[model samples]
Target: MPRHQLRLDASSPTIIVPITARDVTELDQSAAASAAAPAGAAAEWRVDLFTPFTDGGGGDPAQAVAALERLAGLLPNTPILATFRTTAEGGSAEIAADSYAALIDALAASGLAAAVDVEYRHPQADRAIAAAHRHGVPVVASNHDFDATPPTEEIVARLEAMETAGADVAKIAVMPRSAADVVTLLDATERRYRQARIPLITMSMGALGAVTRIGGGAFGSAATFATVGAASAPGQLPADGVRAALDLLHRGR
Candidate 1:
């Protein structure tokens, strides 16, 4: 398929498949999963989620870069997101801000990543956003809440902040404490999709929020995250489940 702008609508719900595999065997497993993904889903290769990074507290930055490059080569044409999510954001590793920026720069420079995920709250995020654009790579300005879901107004404000920070796609992942919280996220997503010029990706994490990932496209969420084996976040459905749900939603529409 040609490189198409990922459309976030009933017809096509953007899917971001995770790359959490460790060695070449696991990487191949991820690739196989990607190849077998439903027709409309996109791939998100998360290098930091692999066992190597977690087991060794993350290896040399150069090694990580090399690994990303190799994985990119394996999964050609799929949109790969270089995400080194920090400890503060529920990610495993504790990479320094400067080093993280350098890694993003190197990935962009190498043309290995289609986009990079930068936290909206990070101090150096603006610089990273600028650099990614400079190298012709898109940036997904992201925020995550492991504790609890903020109100709908707060979610809107957070997305607005990401937009102001120069993000191509504004992403928010919140931990929903109840069904009502998921509704709040959906409401915010609908409002932002209608008002904001850029694409919006919103998900409420944990068991209470799993349905949002399945039904989010109907509420105007741009993408949903899924893993090949283990979930990167709580309440993440498997790729097949996501595909089936999206298909059912589209059919119903």
Candidate 2:
């Protein structure tokens, strides 16, 4: 498998494209087009093997891994981040904690993906991190609050928790009820970014929070999620749109 470690820093924030695959062939075509594009973006395939957010219905662990392997064959040069978001976390499917850990372990071992996005609430979060490290793949500890944005301190606390668990990157997504909420989320991201050793993928969701999606890097966010074909979250701009926004924002900085 190819190596896929994200290069994020204080100066340069990257764009991430989320791919919600309906089928292997669809994923391959979308990924192939993205691979041929000039945009500097990473691909995140949502492997909802048992999740409710899957395009058609639930799938087994083997199906998820098989799909990933197929995609790897098509995009040898593209870095893929495997994610299995659960229903409770605004995803469509659910897998027991043990099963989740086992699936992540398998993905890490396969080397089909550069990183695995394991939920922060995963029962064996620490174990998952260790397993990914053993396989030389990164763990992205992620949390999402679709209802409201938490205080900056609470957000930082969560990011720190991921770092302590040995995650290479931390991701937090929150919903903003107002413009002020967006500021709170960004402030929290910037604060955590300054203190944490790991890179942060933080964003406030929805139209109210769209500005942060474009200019989040200015406040210490390491990457922004955009859509290549289908969007996984609210207010996610197209990859080119995101790239253009980032370029426009940075030129002024």
Candidate 3:
């Protein structure tokens, strides 16, 4: 397989386009469309959106691996960040904590994805982080607050917690209720960025927070999500537009 790692320290933030296909056929189509993303952009496989995983509780680990292989074949040049978000975190699927950790362990060991996202608050989060590290795969430990943005101190604490858990990257996304909320999220991001040992990904979701998706790098966000065909989250802009904005905002920095 081709080797491509997602980097957050680039002059411009890494533009990650979500691939939200539900099946192999749809995955093929989505993978093709993702090629239209900016030249250096990466693809995030929203594995929870895949029907096989959503059919019952959690899908077969073998099936998930097979699907990942197919995606890797389809987009050899694009780095893939595998994310099997659960319903509790505004995702489509629901899985037991043990099952969730096992899936992450399997995915990390498979070496198909450039990085794997593990929810920070999951009961077995530490287990998943350790397993992923044993395989030399970076883990993007993440937390999402779809309700509202937390206080700046709380946001920074969560990021620090992820780092302490041995994650290679720390990510958090929060829904902003007002313009001030967006600023709060940004301030937290910059604060964590200044002290963080690993890369950080932070965003304030929704229309009021859309600016973060385009120019969050200025405030220390290492990466931002964008849409290729279907959006996996609120306020995700078109990948091409996000890429251009990131370049413009971070130019000459």
**What would the C-alpha RMSD of candidate 1 be, to one decimal place?**
2.6
The collision pairs in model 1 are: none
Model 2, 1-253: lDDT tens digits are: 3366667764567887877766656776777766754356788888773233254434566777777888877777767889888887888677777777877888888888889988887777877777777888888899999999998899989999988888889999999998889999999988888888888889999988988888888888888888767789999887787787778778755
Query: C-alpha displacement of 40 in model 2, angstroms?
Result: 2.0
Per-residue lDDT tens digits for candidate 3, residues 1-253, read 2156778773478888999999999999999999888898899998898988889856887888899999999998889999999888899998888888888888888878899999989888999988887877899999999999999999999999999989889999999999999999999999999999999999999899999887788888889999889999999999888877777787788
Q: List lDDT for all candidates, in order.
A: 0.78, 0.80, 0.89
Q: Which stretches of model 1 miss by more than 4 angstroms? A: 1-11, 50-59
Question: Candidate 1, residues 118-232: lDDT per residue as tens digits?
Answer: 8888777988888888887888899999999898888999998889888989999999878888889999988877778788888999889988888888777878997666678
Error of 1 at 75 (Å): 1.4
Clashes of 3: 0
lDDT-best of 1 and 3: 3
Best-fitting candidate, measured by lDDT?
3
Best by TM-score: 3
TM-score of each: 0.90, 0.91, 0.97
| Order by lDDT, highest first | 3, 2, 1
Question: Who is ahead in TM-score, 1 or 2?
Answer: 2
